[model samples]
Target chain A: MANNHAGLPSPTLGDLVLPKLYSLFGIANKDSLYGAVAEFEDGPQLVAAGAKVKEAGYTKLDALSPFPVHGIDDAIGVPRSILGFIVICIAFCGTFAAFLLMWYTGAYSGPQIPGCELVGLCSYPLVIGGKPLFHWVFGLPIMFELSILFAAFASVIGMFALNGLPRMHHPTFNYSGIHRATDDRFMLVVEASDPKFKAEETLELLRSLGAVHAELVEDK
Target chain B: MAGHHHDHAVDSYQLDPGKWSTGRNVLAFIALLSWALLGFGYFNDHERFFQSYLVAFCMGTFIILGATFFVYVQYLTGSAWSVPIRRILENIMVSIPIGALLFIPIAFAGVDDLYKWAKPEAISDALIQAKKAFLNVGGFRLRAGILFALWSIWAFAIWTSSTKQDKTKSIEQMKTSSRWAAPGLLVVCLTGCLAAFEWIMSLDPHWYSTIFGLYCMAGGCVAMWATVTLISLGFRSNGVLANTITVEHYHDLGKWMFALSVFWTYLAASQYLLIWYASIPEETIYYKERMHGSWAWVSVLLPIGRFVVPFALLVGRSAKRNLKVLRIAAIWILFMEFVDMYWMIMPNFHEYAHGFHLHWLDLAALGGVFSVYGLVFWSRFKSNSLVVEGDMRFEQGLHFHQV
Candidate 1:
């Protein structure tokens, strides 16, 4: 289901001339190159291509497949996620916040003396089962619960944030064979920002490496 | 994970029986020496001997039962990752009969000394007297007999079927285990919980927590994971199954140890929180006895040592992968399980009012029971292939990797 423009007529004068005029006037063009896209038949083929491109000094590489490719992270040099560290920090804050809330309402909000006309307090006081006004032994359950709750929320939100989710589009979508990435094929992209990017050479390299299809994608 | 070879063809699943002959003899000698010491304790300090024996008995018995439960779980879940190590656990599970044999001392001799409900003076207490039918010695013996019989039958059934599959190489054996696993799990859970109530909980006839059985099971399961890890590590160090049971398997075992430790804390907190909030005298009495005097240190140590230390130590992925860290943690967890059992059973002794005291017989009995049980386990373990080669997913287990 690739977008085949082969049957269409060749580009008119504006297609080739407007981009030069646009560049002369410092105006951006939709035809700006985003990346070179390659399609491979399977995960191993894509992983091999990833390793070769990385070895060739292409740092801005990405891959898309219907399933996770096990060694692709190492091949593509993806760093380990720091979401665990983020979640733990949030959990500690939650645990402290829970204890603070309990201490404020259970003990600090009220006067230490037996009787005092305390006013403008957020909470009066609470004493249950002859326990201390704010003993941690009694407060541990709530503290543990809040820590877990905050950690859960942080993981979900942190993962989405770290992944830059909720977006409508990505540069990889500009490839004509992109849709097949989610179905049968594996897609590898070498971004135009990479220092090693030479459109024709990269495309030739991917083709030589056994890509089923290779093409340069535009920003639009 | 580096510098380790994964040449599965080179790995030998056969354990040379003669290789462990020294270990067996040492264990047997220790068992003989400790049994003689325990015999002296039994004749001299009758009550203390039963108390110490019960603690050691529950320690070994619960772990064996937990192994049985674990084996059934692997079958029920159809877990391929545990296939290589399932035989080690099955060997432990099959030693339930030895555990039953060890209980003969407590069942026939120590019942009168151990259980207050078995004593005539317990009938004077209205609350305990009200439960005479189930709490009596006759009923306790009958229930103990049934519990042992059921556990032995199920353990042998699973072990025999799985071992027989080694030669048959049949998928029907897997189906058979999966079929029985459902009912087997139910039977083990019910009977195991009942055994916990009869053996340990009955030590305090007046005080009861519905969560005690689960607490016991959770501790035993953690100890079982630690035991399995230690045994696996032992085999590796002995140059047996060094390649077959790899770091991946050890990592999984470490995860079980950590998860079960947390689960144990959950059950322990559930039991404590309710009684603490309600302030019921009978329920609170159990904690009160342990939480005061010198016992308070142990009560505090239980959570810190068993839950907090292990949780922090093992929570990291790297720590579980590190063999040295995992080894220390397993041994620590095993020690904590014993401390937990000691905390549960020791406070019921008459000397408890005086404060915490570790009797010499406690060591003698522990060494005695564990050594004898170790011999039983070695025999069963050596009789079969160290790994389950017949398992349909054995290769999957061998190649198991966490992404």
Candidate 2:
């Protein structure tokens, strides 16, 4: 499907000349290059480019915009996040732990008081405020709070874990003009590792999709 | 981006009702058979008939009322994501009058059998006398009449104004509907509270929970979402609105169902925990009666079936987006909703019985009420666009995708 670049010529000798020269000189070899970075004026153009690349079956692609672009995830076919499920599971564990802890500390009495009857084996039941030993009502507030606490903890930690964030460096930073990605420009990166990525054809596709500036950035 | 060029013209998007005629006829036949069974139950076991009828009536009423609230809130929030399914909600609301009509049997014939306060002899008791002002048959019927009248008026106004905008395409109509919806919501909440108290909660006149109305409303919302999801899926499978109502919308609907199920559980637990902790006789009697026999199993099952199972299944994003998983969740929630209503109403009759008893009349009444309600909704839906094709935000909804 990537080869079906209609109304466009197949890559010729001129398209491969620059990479061949870079490899021969060893200044910035093809293997050391990151990918093609295309900068657009705004969100719409970036989303369009992302969609175009996705339709062309380019798997290793990323889009960065100053603000969140709606529908860009679908255009790029991003998988749904599993962070919510993880947080919920953590919250449930928190709730269970809180309930058990409350029961042990508040409900489970030590075998110190004489004539303290055990309801079950190892059960020294304490009647606090004339309530049952394991009253769920009294434990509800603690359960709720602990659930929220764990969910908040999981949300932050899980986000970091899933995103593989806190990175100090990336190959994309090797591009001199890529700093605009965090500012007013929307940038799309079609990685060289993608099966469909031919440096010349990918750059041509990006430019045809209205990228204001498209260029290849070296990895090192 | 490529599929964004879909025809925005309203005419091309209208659903063909002819394809649904055979299904509607089959439903009509089943509904007629159920009504016949109800007639048989009425003659054979008047008390059980009334009990079953109350459950069915309240279930149908709440779905319609809940759908009305759903539509009002959508308008109030100016939600774009729901525009594709707004017509389905409106069509559900259009069944309110039919539900009101179905209430006629319960109002006149089943009153004495259903309500303890309806018996004149009960007036001799001091507590019953104290509640006479609100619980008498005259007052009960009058309150029900006013509530249904308000619901019918709001349903008509909202439904007509929305469908009218299909042709007029006027922003004023949208504004008018929003203006009406704001106050209509309050009326719904108020009437819903009072009606729930009169119809279901008052069965055990000595017991009262302030959150009973909210509990019913939460369950109603869940049921409403289930109904909408079921119908939308059916339509999609039949190639109606196949393109317009995509998995994105189903995922949202699934989220609503999951959220409301959680809310319902919260309210149910709050009500139970507060009563259990207080240990007040009046309050605890409700639970005491429910916990007596087979009813105890139901009390336990309510949390598990209604909240825990649905919550566990639907908490995942993929579960909501998967068609088969969603269908199972939707159907499960709907059945749990019926069990909820049954648990509330049927136990009042079996207060002294040792175990749970399933009466054939329960199915008969549910079938009768739902089928009749379904028929009304089908006709109303056929008369309107399956999607809100003419709404200004319709295009936005068609292209909506969750980020």
Give the residue spans of candidate 1 off by over 4 A.
Answer: A1-33, A51-59, A110-121, A128-131, A194-205, B1-9
lDDT of candidate 2 over B49-118, digit per residue (tens)? 8888888889988988899999999999989899989999998987888776898898898898887787
Error of 1 at B10 (Å): 3.1
What's the TM-score of each model vs. the native?
0.89, 0.86
How well is each residue in B1-403 modelled by candidate 1, as lDDT tens digits? 2322346655777778787687798889999999999989888998889888888889988898889899999998889889889999998998888777888888788888888888878968898899888898888878888888888888888888899888888998988888878899999888888888889998889888898998999999999999999999988898888878888888999999999999999999888888888888989999889976888999999999999999999988889999999999999999999999999998887777547788999999999999988998888756678877899998788878766
Residue A95 of model 2, lDDT score:
99
Candidate with the greatest TM-score versus the true structure:
1
Among all candidates shown, the one with the greatest lDDT: 1
True contacts kept of each: 0.08, 0.23
Task: State model 2's lDDT.
Answer: 0.84
Q: Which candidate is the best by DockQ?
A: 2
lDDT of model 1 at residue B83? 86
Clash pairs, candidate 1, are: none
Worst 10 residues of 2 chain B by lDDT: B3-12
